[model samples]
Structure formats: C-alpha cells, structure tokens
Target: MTRILLALLLILGFAAPAAAAGDQGWWNKDWSYRKQVTIDSSPSGINATGVIGRTVVLVRLHSGNFTFTDAMPNGADIRFVDTDNKTPLPFHIEHYDSTVGIATAWVAVPNLNGGEKHSIWLYFGAKTAPVAQDEKGTYDPDYMAVYHFGEGPGTASNDSTANANIAKSAPPGVDDAGIIGRAARFPGQGEVQIAESASLAMPAAAPFSFTAWVKPAQLAGTQAIFARGGLTIGLNAGVLFVSGPGVSLQGKAPVKQGDWNAIAFTTDGKEGHLYVNGLEQATGPAALGAIAGPATLGGAAGQPFTGELDEVRLSKTARPAAMIQAMADAEGKGGKLVTVTETAEKQSSGGGVFFFVLSKLEGVDEIVVGVCLILTAISAFVMYNRFAYFAKCTKGNAAFMRQFRRMDGELVPSAEIPGLDKKEARLIKTSPLAHIYDVGIEEFNRRKARLGNRPLSSQAIESMRAAASEVVVHENHKLDQWMVILTIAISGGPFIGLLGTVMGVMNTFGGVAMAGDVNVNAIAPGIAAALLATISGLFCAIPSLFGYNYLNSQVIPLASDMGIFIDQLLARIAETQAEEAADNAMGGFGDDDMAMMEMDDSF
Candidate 1:
C-alpha cells in the first residue's frame, strides 16, 4: 500500500506538463500570441436583422481594447484567421500608429447571420513575420470605390478596392481628428471628384448604394455630400435628402449638427431609401436613366458641403439594410459590436501546471512558494524513509520472536535458535527484541560467574531486569528519530503559505490602487496568483499529516513487543536459576534415583 501511494505521487510530480487552456490547434506555431475577436449581431449587441452576406467589416483597435506593445511596429506582424484557426482571412490596415496605440483594419467576413455571433482570430507577436496586407482582396469586386481619406495633404486619395478609382483632385482641407483617422475637410469652397470609369458608371435604373460618415459644420441651405450626374445626396436644413433623375427621397430624421452621422442612400432601381445613423429615415419610388458624369464628394459645381467626410464607400449593388446597420454599429464612436479578448501567450511543451500562475506572481510570492515546495520535498523524503525503516523493524522483530518462542526455558543466543537460516539470523541480529534479550543474557552470565554455584538473589534479578528495561527505552528513542520534521511540516506549512498569500494580495491591490483602474480583469489575475501560495502550503502539509500518524502507529507495536520480550526473558532466567538451586541443595540426587530405591524395597 505504501509503495503504491508513493508511486502515484512520483508520477504526478514528474508528469508531462500540459498547455494552458485546451488545444485550439493554433493557426501557426511561429506566432507567439493570439486574441479572439467576436462580432456580436445578437439582440444584446448590434441586433442586425437578416443575413448579411460576404462584406468587409472594420476592426478598430485602441489602447482600451488592444495591447500595442505585443505587436511589431506599424502592425506588420498582424494576421487575421477565420474561426477555424487554420484558414487565413484577407485584411488590410487602413491606419496604424503604434505610438498612439490606435489602429483600424478592414477584414472580409464570409457571412454574418442576424441574431448570431461570429468569431475570428487575430494572431501577432512574431518578430520575423512578413507583412500580410491585402488591400484589394479585402473588398469584394462589387465595391467600386472605398476611400479611407488617410493620405497626406495634397495627395489624391487612393481607393482600397480592386477598382482603382482614385480621386481626381486633393481635398482643399484635411482634418486629422476625423472619426476614424483622417477626413477631408471642405470649407464650402472646393470639392473632391472622381472621374467616371467603367466601374463607377451606373447604367439606367441600376442598383446602387453610397455611404459615408459626415459631420456637418453648419446646417443652413442645401449642401451636397455626394453627387454624380443628376444623383445628389445632400443635407437641407440639417435633414437628409437624396435626388436623382426621377428620384427624390427626403429623410425626416434630421442629421445632428456638429456631430458625426452615418449617412447612406441605397436604391434597387425601383425605389430609393435614405438612412441616417443606421436607421431608415425615408423611402420613396425612384429611378434613373443612364448617368454620365464624374462622381463628386463634399460638393458639386454649385453646392459645397461645409463639413468633414470620412470612409466614403460606393457599391454597385444595393447593400442590405442589415449590412449598413452593422457598419454603423461597428464604426461609430465607442462602438461595442466588435469585442477583442485579452491576449493569450503560447506555452511551451515543458510548461507546468503552475507555470502561468508563477509567471504572474511577484518576487516575494515566488520566494514564499519556493519555500513551500522545498518543505514538500522534505516531508516526502522523511515519510518514505521512515516507512521503510518501520517495515524492516517489523519484519525482523516477527522473525526473532518466532525463534525465541521455540527456545522453551533455555536462555540461548538468538543466533543459535534451531532451523534458522542466514536470512533469519540477519533478521534476529537487527531486531530490537533480540538486542534486549542479549543484554539480559550478558547480565545473567556476569551474575552467575560471580556467585559460582549459588542462585541469583531477588535483588540481582531486579537489577538485571532494570538493565534490560533501559535497553528497551533506548530502542524506542531510535524508532522515533526524525519524526519531529513531520510535526513541523504539519503545523508550519499552512502558516508560511498564508504569509505569502497575504503579501501577494497586498501587492496586487497596491498596484491596482496605483493604476487607479479597478476593473475585474485588472485584479483577477493577481488575486488568483496570490491564492496559489496558500494552495502550495496545503500541498506540503496534508500528506505529511497522514504519513506522520501512519508511521507513529507502526512504531507503537514494535515498542510494546520489545517491553514484553524483556519481561519474559527475566522471568525465564529466574525460573531456570531456581531449579538449578533446588537440584544442588539435594546433593545432585535426581527424581529417577529416588524412584529406583523405592522399587527395590517393594521387591
């Protein structure tokens, strides 16, 4: 039983370390960290309705949601993978400023169902990773022009889609403080235009959608935000209005002045709908003939918008309302549609169960846990050694007692017992009872030599018994050697562990108070790491308590056996001496001589 228990413990101590959390089949082993990105379209989130087919979604990263220090400069190491963690998805970075800790990337998702959640993986932290930006591939072919307005001043804005619909002229003004990154600021004087191309050309009554984030500086007369041929999406008296050849749709929901709003207009060739901030504001029958003109943004030849424009997109197909809603929910300020989880580090194959906890521990906590581990090792060693020693003593004592019982009344040496083999002889030599018997035999021989033929008196027998009793006491002291170490472990281990835990918790709260952010994520890891010290303490103490009791129980019986053997040895010596004295007193005349004389008289 002892062997089995020890074997199990040894196995646990040396078992192969496991990875942190379950295996998710990492996309690539080279990347050292990955974070899960979830896009929630459920009721609790954006609540987008209907199936939003393949589309490009923006992933915004800032100091609040991302750790900039983990990624390389300019986010060159960044890679987006699908939920399967094996397939890489196409993504392109629109803006990345590591020093400011803000970035925005657009990734093409295969599908997003309403009332459902979609997940993707963002892997980074590789030192030698190559740049994986796919600008053209990030947007579908239906997208005619997608402008981020992030280019430097006086430079024409480049389109991100496959269609190279660059701006015909630079913006008159540029605002670095735009909603996402940079925006084209129009002071109601000049406008940016895109020359008509095969991709930008809209046929008669064709499906079309135009969306942009607009912040109107003033709401007075009509201001054209977008226009091409006879199609014009403008703001009149702070209200949204879209007009084309035979289409005239006006929105009742007024655009908030001096604030950004997602303005969009989508027409399915039969009807046109206007949206403000992701909600449908107005709808009416609309149609258009073949349009032939350059697409103008921020103004036309007569009306110029006095505001900022950003993230302007033009699609050949009329985008679904759900997609527009999702975009508005995700790109708006302080949006919650996309949630990026905390980063997870890659674990080596040799990592242990406490590896993560230990990594989080402070220096003082590490020292405390180290002490507990040392105590655990000490206790295990003591328990194993003591148990083995007790087993040997028990076996030898049993063998010695058996041989001594067969001696009848003779006080003979343990080695001279009949039918004894070398093994039994060795057992008797190490047995405590055999040692006590040898002490008694030596004292008896000393008394016999001094008294000649006289028997030992009562005083001499008492003295000899006292000598044997002293040997039994000495044997018990030897049996109890090193048991104090177990007592120390049982009593002191928990207290030591508690000291570490208290110190760790103090450090954790102190750091939090210093940081002045009291969120659960900021405090949970520290508290959990602090508790590890207490666990280590219990780990050291529990097994020692059980082992101490078990070993002490085994020692008690052996000590009792030694005492009993001492008493029997003295009693047998006294009985043999008394018989010898009686025989001597009768002048050596045996019982046989008396019986023979009585028979002769009868004849």
Candidate 2:
C-alpha cells in the first residue's frame, strides 16, 4: 500500500494539468508573407500571397540569425528564411488554395492555354535560427521565415526557367504598365513568363475551378489566360476565353488595378466563366476537345505569364461564386482593415461627460444664487432707506425750526400771547439772561408755585439755554440711529459672507489636493460656490455703508444747528432783559419780545 501511494504521488507530481484557455496570441500581426531568402546572385525568390485584405510580409536574410519571439499556436505552419545569403530558386505559392496561407481564400489563376486553376491561401508564422560565419565572412545560411515568393536572377539564365520563356512580356492592348509591369514582389518580374513546367493536364471526367489574385493589369489584353484546340481556356486581369484564332470575353466591370482582386474561374466542362470578388465578371466557351494541362500557373507554354502570379490554385470541381464572395467579405471585415476606418472616424462621446456634469448642478446653484442676491439687494435697499430716512428727518427738522421761526416772527406780546403766565412775565425782563423767553416764562410760573417765587437770574437763564441745547442734541440724534444699524448690517454681513467664502475655498482646494487635481474642471465649481457668499455679503454691505455714512453726515449737522439756534435764543432774550423787566412791571411782554426770540433762535 505504501509503495502504491508513493507511485501515485510521483505520478501526480509529474503530470501536467490542463491549462486555462486564453485569447489567441496570433491576433492582427502582419506575418502574412514572411519568406526566408538566401540570395546567391539574386536567384532567391518568395512565392506567397494573402487574401484581398490581408497583410503580407516577405524578408530576405543574408546569413543573419533571426528570432521570432511570438508565442503562436502550432508553433507556426512554415518557416522559409535562409541566413547564408545563398540564393535559391523561387518557391511556388499554390494560389487559389482555400486552406494553406495566412488566410484561407479561394482564388483563380488563368493559364496561357486558357485553362483556369483554383487554390487557397496559406499561413506561416514566426521562428528563429542562428547562423555561423565563414572564413570569407560569408555566414552559413540559417534562418526561419514563412513563405517563398518566386525570385529572378535579374536575367533569364539565372531566373526560374519557367520565367525565362515568356513569348510576350506585355501582351497586345495592355495600356498601363502600372497595372502589369509592376513587380510581383520587389525585384521580381511582374511580367509573364512561359515555360513547360507550369502546365498540368485536366482529367477526362471532372469539372474544375481555378482561383488566383490579380490587379487588372491592363484595360484590354488579347487573352490574359486562354487556351485553343481541344484543350482549354485562358484567364487574365480583365478578359477570359479560349486562345483560339480570336476568342475573348471581357469582364463586365474591369478588374480593378492597384488593388488586390480575387478571381474565381469555374466550369462544368461545358460552359466556362470568370468571377471576380465572388461576382461573375464574364463567361466564355470552354474548350470542347480532350483535356490538356489541368492547371498552369502564369501563362501557357511559350507564352508563360505576361503578368504577376501568386497562389495559383486548381480544384477538381466547380465552386460557387457565393462561397468565394463570403470569404471575400470576411477578409474585408477583418480587424486590420476596419482599424484604420475606426481610427479616422474618431467617435468621441464627451457629450455624456457634459451631461453628467451639468446634472450635478441642476436647480440648486441657480436657486441659491438667486435667493442670496435678492436678499442682499433687499438688505442693501433697507440700509439705503435708513439713510434716506435720516436724511429726510434732518431736513424736516431744519425746515421745522425755520418755520417755527417764521411763525414766531409776529410773536404775540405777553399780553397778546394767551399761553404766557403772569409770574413768567413779572420777572422776565429783570433777569440778565433775558433772551430765554421759552425757559423764563415757564421757570417763573413754576417758581411761583413754591420756591419758584424767587426772581430769575442771568446764571439761571444761561443754565436754561444749556438745557435746551441738550434736549435738541438728544432729539437730533434720534433719526440718525439707523446709521449704526445699517452700518452693522451692511459691513458685518458681507464680512461674514466673505468668511464663509474663504472657508468654502479652503474646503474646495483641500478636497482638490486629496482628489489629485487642480484643473479648472475640478476647481471652478467649488470656487464659484465659495465666491457666492462673498457676493451676497457685498450685495448687502454696499448700500448699508453708503446710507449709514450719508445719514451720519446729514443728522449731525442738523442737531448742531438746533443746538446753536437754542443758544442764540438765550442771547437775544438776554439782550432784551432790561426792557422786558420794565415791560413786566407794566404787566406785559410786547410782540417785540417773542419776535426777537424767534429771530435769535433762527441764527
């Protein structure tokens, strides 16, 4: 039992558990064509292609080591790099294949003899290899790449033999070299090459499909890929038909050049037709004789290819155009193509942020500011009213005093004035302080009642004047009290409000520090709230201060004037005292005595 347990434990320790599934690591990389090249006199080439929308990358290493750090699945399907710079012949990329390259796509390649072929795309990922240096400094070739696009030795002798025999590099009616003469891959002949090795025989009993990628090389070409006699059909950028004495069918819409175009050619052995991007572009008569070469890349023998060729394919049965179109659509929809569009579109949704921010301030801010400002304005107005009240009070008092003087102008004599008492007049003129008519008449009457029987004296009259002055001072100060009240209301309220603002600002900035930003977006609103209090305070304070000061300046002088008038009354009465004493003995104060009191008091 112990041995069994130990064995189980050992097995458990050594065994690996199933790993959690994860996202694919090969997403969106541009390793579509990573051909490893070792050029010996420019003989090396890469034969690879991608779907219409896929990326293709081809590299040549001259004896340098390469490292592919990408952790891809299946450890990569193909590696084609050569490190030693030893040039090799171009490798064929079976075009029109649907399951072998970076992306599986159906394509059609037309034969020079007019037979069409179909193949699919292939995928080859990254790998690494180290090279060794030679005595002549030429490194031993060691590299890892993905595909091998065909290469040319800059001459027919050094190039792939099949590429050296083309009858025509530019066929008749091919107007633009931009579409045709362009390199298939850099330094490789975009022109067609004909050779015996590229042809294959179609079987006697089966239908066929041909597929490849092409850019409409020329607007018009005699026979891009065609055949004659009993053996087949041809294919090309724009037209497809039998290469008879003269047989051609042009594409309804010319194959677009300067862009990768996917073409599919399918036939039921009776009617042969061409399809571009999954849409039937043209139809032609199939060769009605014995089957010849079933598949041929580039052009027919002696004719070879007059244009670039990659990923040529041939299927034993005709394929539907919709299936090819679906694949094309899929390629068009890949993230690589969409990425550029989405980036350029720049669909910013900041409106959401704006809405969210404004939502926070709904109603509260407007309501608060409105109420505060209104209250402040009202308070300010109240203070202003207080000042105006005092202003009116002072002016009224001054006018009242003047009117009193005017009324006193025809003052009733002691005899005529019904209000004067007899004791008030008996000693009114004998006193040295005589202008105190208001006080003397009252004092004598009061004296007569008890110890008031004593006669008046100049000192007593002077004391009376001083007493009236005090009363005037007290009365004058009454309306001016609003000054102090208004001053406190205006000045103090705003200060308090400012204090609130300071506190609010401190809180806002403090929170800002905690939140880690001082941007206007973060700070403006808080500062606005803080400042609201200050605004309220000022709104309350300004009028208060203005009115308070205005009232104070106004009321003080009125009080002073009243007191001065009272003093003057005493002096005028004093001057008339001797005359009044005689007149009192005569038992009368004439109109002159009252008139003089009124005039002196007006001063």
Candidate 3:
C-alpha cells in the first residue's frame, strides 16, 4: 500500500510538469496566414473574388489553441503589416466581436491597380502589452456621444457609445477623405441635426466638452459650425468664437482656410476655454446657465459654413489636460495609441485552463471526478494483481510439467522431486499439473497398500482418475479468482460517469435559470466540467477492458492445458492398472492368501 502511494505520487509529480508545459504551449501562441487576391475592375467599381477592396470583410482569426465563438473575423481586425509595394493600403478595423472571434475592417484598395494581384501577409495576436486607444491605456466612459461620421449614402451617422444617439444628415452623404475611413460631409445648404433629446442636452451649468475636426473652405461673415439655442460656436472672419446669450469668448489666434484643424472647447460654469490643434488659445468667463436647445451642425437658415467636418465628440464631464492631450495625440496623424479589437483580458495569454475547469465544474462534477479517480485506482490494482498471479501460475505450471515429464514410470514423492522445495510448493499450489499429480500419487499409494503386492482392481484405478479430475476442476477455479472485479470496473465505469455528466448538465441549466444569464461565460464552465466526467469514465474503463481481455485469453489456454494433463494422468493410471491386472491374473492368487499377503505387507 505504501509503495502504491509512492508510485501514485511519482506519477502525479511527473504529470504536473508535463501538463504545465502543455498549458503554456497551448495558450501562449499566435496564428498567421497570407493570401493574394487578383483584382478585376468594372465600370461600377473594382471587384475581387473575396473582400479585396476597402470594403468591410468578416474574418475568422485564431490566436491560441481554443475555439472562439465567432466564426468570421473582420478584415479590418487584421492589419497588413507586409504587402506588395504599389501603394500602402490603409486599413482600419470597424468592429471586433471577441465573443465570436470575428472582426470587420475597411481596407482601402484605392491605389491597388485593377487586373493586378496584390500580396498581403496578415499577422494575428502579440505577446507584448496591447496598444491602447489613448495614451493612458484607458477609455473614458464620460463620452456621452462620439460620431466618426462613417456612414454610407442616405444612412444616419451612428454615435459609438452606450447611448445610441444617431445623427441624420439633410443630404445624407459620406466623405471618404476624412481622418477615418468616411466622415459626414455637409454642403453649404445642408445640415445634420439630432432634435432636442435628453442625451444631447447638457445639464444646467454642468461641465461639458466638445471636440471636432473642421476644415473651412471659405470663412466669410459669421458661419455657425455648432449651435444649441442661443449658445453658438462658429468662425467669424478667420476667428473662432463661443457665444452664449450676452457673453462671448473669442480665440486669440486667427484660423486658416482649406486646412484640417482640431478644435475643442470646454466650460465648467466658471470659465470657457477654446483649444485649436491641442493648444489652448483662449479663456473667458461663462454665464451661470447657458441656454440649451436643439443642437444643429452647419447653419440651419442663412449662415451655413462651407467646409468638411469629421470626428465630433461630446462629453458630460470636463476632461483633464492629460486626457485632452492624449486624445489629440491619438486622433492626430501621429500619436502613441494602441489599437486592438478586444480588451486585454480577452486576448490569449496562456492562462485559461485552470479557471475554465473550476468555473464550469459543479459540486456533482467534482464528486463524479473523485469517484472516477477511485475507480481508476481500483482498476489498476485489480489488473496488476491478476496479471502477476497469471504470470506466476504460468511459470509454475511450466516448471512442474518439466519435472513431471522427466520422471520415469514410477511416480516420485513430492519431497524427492528436484526443485520441489517448500517455496516451490507454495508457488505450484496454483498449478493444475502439480495438483493432479499430488492427487494421483496419494490415491495410488492408498490403493497399493490395500492390495499389497497384488495389482489394484479396476475400481481403485477409477477412484484415482476421479480424484485427478476433481483436482483439475479446483485448479481451474483458483486460476479464475478475482476476475469479477475487472468485469465490474469495465461495465460500471462509463455508466457512473454518464450519470455524473447528466447531473452536471441539469445543474448548469438550473444555475442559468437562477442567474438569468445565458451567455458563454455563464454556461461554458458547467458544460466543460460535465464533459470531463465522461472523459474520466472512459479513462477508468479503457485499461480495465484491455486487461480483462488479455487475462481471459491467458486463462483459457491454461484451462485447456489443465484438461489435457488430467486426461494424460488418467491414461497413465489406466495403463499401469492394466499391466498390473494382467500380472495378477497370470499369477491367479487365492482370496485368503491375497488377504494374508496384503496384511503382511501393511505390517
């Protein structure tokens, strides 16, 4: 038992390191692929077999060893780090559904020649810290609304936030030459509006921030870029101004025409500040409560600004200088920003198995696994004991048979047989040949004593034959001992495991009902744990089944050998009796004389 425990511990110790190594290799890895698509231009637009142009394409990308729910990954989620040199194709990811492991990207294949093949190499995942969208490596939730203006013709521009405040353009058009893929383009006569909604209305005298990228083609008389009720911020003759009721704040520096510029403004009931290209240009006192009303971009009636605007963002909180600077750097052409499709936790980092197993396994699952472990131990012990016993029996039978064959016509006593020591007797106890020979020798000696020098009768020979047959049956029974344990293990292991799995699945659904959640996180653990029980059952049964089959094969041959030995022993006895009977018949001794002779020999 102590040795068994030590052997189990050794197995565990060796397995732990191997499992750890496998976990690392399984989790901390990346996948990559490369492809070339030939382009064919048409009058409508350039066409490719797959998503070749700057259109959004779904892609199924893998990073580690596990399967992700999302089958289709986005082309935008993948950046073409290396590609055939023609013109650098600009690509950006629009959305990445990490749950499904799918992403959407818009690839700009404008410069890619039609009817020409473009080679691309796509690399997935990274080992280093992920790049953040902002320098602080955090995304601010204070942004109540963010509009990239990446809408198609006649579609409303969506606000990328928890608050879905969509803006509708009057003419409904998308400009491709914006900071991102597309931006809302407002002609002089057109305007984009989001009627008086609670999401757009800033709380009275509350801190607020507004940022936009604007390029004015012509800065004539006062042209309003943004207006909310009487509060209006616009460019008036090459100068930016923020006006609310009777109070107005003006920028110190003048603005230029036909150039893209980042403009930002913030107010906290006390002061109003304006920033141009991330630099604070002016500051002024703000009214207690600026009038709030319907917000409009581009002049509604007479004063419409003639330019392109892109990337409009509005936040409810007054952002710190660091955050503003970070935003500027990130949105600017050159900035230290990390762009990833998913969060850091969702990325592959080689640490999932432990949590995955723990989270999924219920109380019943643990119990089932424990039961399986016990079954495995029992199965192992049974197989080892039975295998050893069979091997020993086989060896002893060979040795006893070899000695028996060498013996002459006269059977030797057990004590006189070569190599038949006390130790050999203990081992040969399970040997059918040894058992049969011992029975035959004892019976022959008893019959010979009764008949003295006269040969034994047919009845004495039949009695010896019956004794040998009985010994053969007993020896066969000994060979088949403890085999039922193997049968139990092989038959019961899988069913027990299945019961545990069924219970686990039932519990998983019950948990879902109780928690009111049906997501993968809520259910994957329980399902995986339940499945583990079935795997454990197989683990217990497979070896036992194999061992039982092999032992049965060995036992059948040994039983056959035992039957043959019994037959041979009976034949030898019958032949010896026939010779003796012939001698006695030829001598023709009287019954009284025979009786006196037997008595004298016995004395």
Best by lDDT: 1
Compose the digit string of candidate 2's lDDT tens values, residues 1-603: 212221222221432232221223222133332222211111121111222221121121100111112213322333322222222112222211112112111111111111111211222333332221111111111100111122233422112122222232322222111111112421122333323323333544346665555543443443344332333344443444343322234466555544546666666666667777656777776543445422233445544334443323444455555434533332321211101000000011122222222222213333433444554555556666755565555444443344335433233323344444564444433322222234544543444355422344777676666666555545645555445556566657676666767776676566444332234444565565566556555655675667667666766665556556676665544444445455555555578897997899999
Q: Which of candidates 1 and 2 is the stronger one according to TM-score?
A: 1
lDDT of 2 at 531: 63
Question: Which consecutive 10 residues in model 2 have the weakest lDDT in total?
Answer: 337-346
Candidate 2 — what's its lDDT? Answer: 0.39
lDDT of each: 0.81, 0.39, 0.60
Candidate 1, residue 202: lDDT: 89
User: Which is the better candidate, 1 or 2, if ranked by lDDT?
Assistant: 1
Off by over 4 Å in 1: 1-24, 345-603
Rank candidates, TM-score, best first.
1, 3, 2
TM-score list, all predictions: 0.57, 0.31, 0.43
Off by over 4 Å in 2: 1-385, 406-456, 513-518, 572-578, 586-603
In every candidate, how many clashes are there? 0, 85, 13
